[model samples]
Target chain A: MKIHQLSVFLENKPGCLSAPCRALAEAGINIHTLSLADTKQFGILRLIVRDWQQAKTVLESHGNVVNVAEVLAIEVEDKPGGMASVLEGIERAGLNIEYMYAFTIRRGDRAILVFRFEDAEKAAQALSKAGINVIDSVALYDLVEKG
Target chain B: MKTEHCDVPFNNVSAPDFLAVAKLRELQLQRLQCIVDRAYNHVMHYRDAMEQLEVRPEDIRSLDDVRRLPFTDKTALRDNYPFGLFASPMNEVVRVHASSGTTGKPIVVAYTQADVDVWSSVMMRSFAACGVHAGDIVQNAYGYGLFTGGLGAHYGAEALGATVIPISGGNTERQIMVLRDFGVTVICCTPSYFLHIAEKAAEMGMPLQDLPLRAGVFGAEPWTENMRRRIQELTGVRAFDIYGLSEIVGPGVGIECDQQNGLHIFEDHFLMEIVNPDTGDPLPDGEEGELVLTTLSKMAMPMLRYRTHDITAIKTDPCPCGRTVRRIDRISRRSDDMLIIRGVNVFPSQIETALLAVEGTLPHYQIIVDRQQGLDGIEVQVEVTAELFSDTVKELEALKSRISHAIDSTIGLRVAVSLVQPRTITRSEGKAKRVIDRRTN
Candidate 1:
């Protein structure tokens, strides 16, 4: 299963985000899933898109210190307790969620969650067994096109 | 009964540890004979090299035969790359380690299983010379795997019958925890790392004196006598220098004994030579020149007359502790690392000596050399300790000026001063890179 995500390590500056976004636009790489994990002076732009490798190549060629990691992409209902339930399922499966960030939403009470866990395969299986309609990229693209 | 202690200082006994001396000389000759015979018989490189010198194995009779042969440089090692220098076949080689090539591409050297045993024995002497005993546990914090520091010390400490704790560098908290729980009595690490460990121990309210560490074998970088005194004082343990290179062996080709005098060369396993680096002519004893070594017992890759670039005096005078073999003083400096700042010779070791002498700053320091306005100038960026910087503004300024003056008085070269925060300079687990030569690159 492919989870198209982006990781951009940017030094804090006025036009840091603009340069990366501008780079993505220049390369014609669209950002489908995006969230910013920020610290005091720097931010990591977590992203999910159609082509993860292409996005990484485009950003890296522009001279950036970046890294790519394997993560789970989850589809949750656009409701208040959607995230809490998925996390509880992971907890029930004897797994821990290291970190998570929200990407874009497709439609009607449904959102995309980018998650990192101690064990990625196990987490995905547990969420799948919990009757969660976890959509992969093909399904996600169809949903995006439909909405 | 044959320890170095029984020998007298001024007896002028023709043999220093007559047993060790005779055994060493005999092994040295045998290894030399084998090397020459191996070169003439096995590899075409040595044959061509010796032919170019117009000398043959038959020409060499005694130890002096080494002079007739040509010296090997890093370029030669690179040209043959992988295993060009090995006298034995590549299949016989079982291990390999490399030096950190800060200057250029790293140089690789190979070792056989027998060669590995030789290296471990050398390191065993390195620890034993520093008072490491069989009953104690050893915490080897030297980086493991590709780097020779950890594993070199690792095998040697284990050979000495000490409980080996292979805690490869970093994670100071966990390192300290293991040190306390296992009651480690010996530490093997680079000098800079030991200092950083001491700082961490102080921060955690851990009484370092209460720990069981009695001695440490420190190497992989050149350190000053003053730095040695500071490490001994801070960690409450005796520390000694273990000197070697991957081209020759790792961790122990020679070692410093407890007297804190100088590193005793293990002449049995390896033969050392001092020569003028530029001219390549052998220097007389006690002359400070570039150090070169030829492996006698080396099997996989026998480095024939390799230049070490380290500057030190070799004293064969029987030490007070009674080791009759040659002992090298703490490395004065490396010819490669010598920075000619405005016609003045500047070395990091000298700067370390001066900085340790001064009172106000922490050990973390940087030398910023800049070229501007068609003239060169040097600036020393030192970190201020909380104890010294917390006083008053005048006191802080005074500290900077005082450090500048100390440097000036020592080197007779003026340098500008800039004070930084504690830990301002990056702490390195390996050799600390302190010099910022912005003059050209």
Candidate 2:
């Protein structure tokens, strides 16, 4: 399963982050999680939101260059060696992870980690073979609503 | 050989090579006759010079006959003053631009609507040669005013349909800010000034190589290959050398194409020549000498055989860009003592005029020009009178400021003015030594 994420281009200046945040708020679009990548001149704001199509439209209408990328949301044990175990499997499978981030909320004894891989399709197959519980967009949204 | 008659005169020429060269010569001849006729009829200076030499417009039948025409120099323009050299009436002249001459009086140039259009067309071609296209954001950093660099690049970028930011020089921080915010893909300015900006950008923790700027059009001063390599390594921009002078038109005369070997001259509008500086004899192709230019289509003021005094050679080899126009080597030397300080032409006589205008300063002065930390710095050392030298420090400071202000107002460049005792500056018997340039490149 894959999740859609919106990456926006913005200048690294004051109020640049709030502009899109305010736009999403006015449009009633909920952002599940967001991470900011920055350089000296500008920054890229990556957002995982519900109703990504509507959110992208809202952000673009406010003059932002937005790109949609597919990322995977997988559940991991909330133990010390959970991430290491997933990394060992990924290394054996020869799947390259570009970046990853964690969600604030979690299920009973598990945590959700969003990962961006070089090839999402192949990574999805490898994770499925490894018996990892991957959450689809609908299930992810349902989990967010419950929390 | 043509078997049948055609409406177009040269349509029957068969060989492509012959046709191309012949057609270019035909256009040059036609335009040359027109310009000479216009200059000879309207301008009194050209008329008197041509009459004294016993040469008429009809004498210029072949391109080689250009040698028969009188050579026009900067002094001729100064002699004509504000509007004497202009062939068109003042009402029809759309614009006037003045640049620093050898003396206090600046050389004035005029342009009609058609002349301005020609300038824009050539500049658009220049940008295209440098791989700049429409929709590219061009940041023009040349000084805007009577100087032609700023407005020339501005109008050309706008005419090319690119978005132009008219940020005319200075304010290095603001330049970097606008460059990053507007996603400027191209920048037009002098090479030294661009280096200064790059230095400031680095100091501000914003390196230029990280920005989206892709190309730079640098001109108005001579730069070397080493500096080009340094700029490219530092900022990752494809630096292109553009050559021009206000006496001709502006910075649209010629530019280095993607080949980056030599600058291709727009032969359709301006004719090029290289002549021996001392003898004024026309040199063959590939010989280094003085640069002479003749405007083919300028209506307001048509310059016939104007000596540019810039030393460069003509490239006889064909360019990969496929344009039939010829190319010229980059200019690295001049035949005179005119110093380009921060892209403004500075002559010793202009400095002398500025220093003499101040009350307590003597005519004995020396200009020292150097390139320190990638920027051109000029310091004027002048001798003060015995009374002014013995005066209080406050009055001496005031005199220094007045002399500096006079120079700034005359040449549009800020320079350091230092006052010295009289007779300290060595006096030469024949000619006084005025300029001492320490720049290696």
Candidate 3:
């Protein structure tokens, strides 16, 4: 019902964003989805990777502050209103969504939407009740590997 | 001849203020002998130190023999704790003051009524040196507590027959209001805090230059001359540096005259010396080294050759302002590991103490000191457990703020707290380098 997301702290320099990506790529860790939250001085690079532990180790070895957070990864329809429907269900459940990013699954005509919520467990239950497919860590890793 | 555009040529034209070099040395010798005798007969710590040197009080026959005395440092005060260094008994003691003791126990000093009078007179001289006169309104913004800045300036203003507003630090809006309503003419605070006040005034759409403030007596921390220029440019006030420590006396140890060149040490009250910090050898005038002071007039706690750790040189040339007392250059750096952040003396161990007291924080931390926009900024980066790292962003932010607040309470200086992942801080082999002072660069 939850997925592991890797967050790395980066100073707002020219090559900060690429540095982490290169580190992950060199470590053979595939990034499933990413969303960047930034301010004037620094930025937080949030990545949902197939091998999050390896991604964290690689980033930390590069002197970056890395944290692993549990988030919900849900598979939604690839149509235009797919993300909107999932957000509507989350809004109705009173579970706030901090941020979300999406990536397409290789085989199915669906997209994987990674969500950070105030309460991950509550968000997962609310999405499940709304008949949405909540993918666990193992299933999400498998899909990313397949891609 | 008086210098043009100067407020006053000299604050006091008394005999000692304009004493000839030979006569001043004679007076210093007499006073030095008196304090040595007082300390030897009264304070046991001084007696033990002197005994260890096998030197008698009467051995200080000449000014050069004064070096035969033992040197006192901060550790002496710590070992004695509250009032072990007082030459006068507690029953006769009139007041007590202390350092923040952020790293450990606070160093306490007591003063008798006569010593308090001496402190006030020196403070008055300090204000007058900056051209602050009687009938002026003084706003004393130094924090009043165990810290000595507030009451030290407060009594000096009162003794100078100036109206004093005892508005301590903080409450920025109220400070501005008083600057306007009370028509403050002189402000006493740290140079950094004064700039902060000026910034706040600008934020409130008020021009600090338009206020009646004319002079600012800033001390209790080291500030650069460029900062002084910025302060003068912003507030249209003459910023003068006042130097002192609780171990010596409070805020009136030395002050810059209208010359604005260097601070004039009140030679009549304090005997000043500059010695090599590493070797303890006395350096000649114009040579920068650690400052050593001896109380010539203090009755209760007469510090004898106390190593101040503040690094500066003395200027022996006579000033055009007609004062014979030598002036010390602005303090640039300390020989020790003390950091003056936002005008508060901070040590890395103090931050470590605060961080260790708070839960969820590891022992590893680094102190980063930088000068941002002509003011000192401190950031404490602490490594926390991975469990705390796995917490939600909101919780992590709360924890960071909590650590910051805890450190603020401990050191009385605001600092940015960064909670990093465990094992992120670099480990040291020999002596751990806890401070990164980027301000010097």
Worst 10-residue stretch by lDDT in candidate 1 chain B?
B1-10
Q: What is the alpha-carbon lDDT of model 3 when measured against the actual structure? A: 0.82
lDDT of 3 by residue, A1-147 (tens): 888888876555688789789988888777777888765545568888776777778888876777777889888778899778877877887888777777656438788787888778888888889887898888877777777
- Against the reference, the lDDT scores of all candidates come to 0.72, 0.84, 0.82
Worst 10 residues of 2 chain B by lDDT: B5-14
The superposed Cα distance between candidate 1 and the true structure at residue B166, in angstroms, equals 0.3
DockQ of each: 0.01, 0.00, 0.17
Q: What are the clashing pairs of model 3?
A: none
Per-residue alpha-carbon lDDT of candidate 1 for residues B1-441, written as tens digits (9 for 90 to 100):
112222223322123223376677777888888877776677677788888999888887889889988788766776776667777887888988765332224457888899998887777766666667676688988888767777898898788788999999878889888877887778887776777677777788885677877777877766667778877777677778888777788768888876888888888777888999889899988888989888887888777788888888788577776666678887767767656453234666567667777873446788887755323578887754434442223344666678888787666568887765434467688444689877441
Query: After best superposition, candidate 1 residue A21: deviation in angstroms?
Result: 31
iRMS, model 3 (angstroms): 4.1
lDDT of 2: 0.84
Please give, as one word, the docking class of candidate 3.
incorrect
Candidate 3 error regions (>4 Å): A1-7, A11-14, A35-46, A51-57, A64-103, A106-147, B1-15, B19-27, B102-104, B171-177, B196-212, B227-236, B356-366, B370-375, B382-388, B419-441
Q: Which residue ranges in model 1 land beyond 4 Å of their true spot?
A: A1-147, B1-23, B101-104, B338-441
TM-score for candidate 3, residues paired by index: 0.82
Q: Is candidate 1 or candidate 2 better by DockQ?
A: 1
Candidate 3 lDDT, B1-441, residue by residue in tens: 112234654455233567888998998899999999999999999999999999998899888887999999888888888888888888999899887564646789898999989888989888888888888899999999878899999999899888999999878789999998887888998887788889989889988888878889999988888888988888888899999998899889999987899989998889988999999999999999999999998889999999988999999787888888899999999998888875577877778878877873556778999876446899888765544453345566777788889888888778988765445467788444689988752
User: What is candidate 3's TM-score for chain B alone?
Assistant: 0.91
Best candidate according to DockQ: 3
TM-score of each: 0.58, 0.70, 0.82
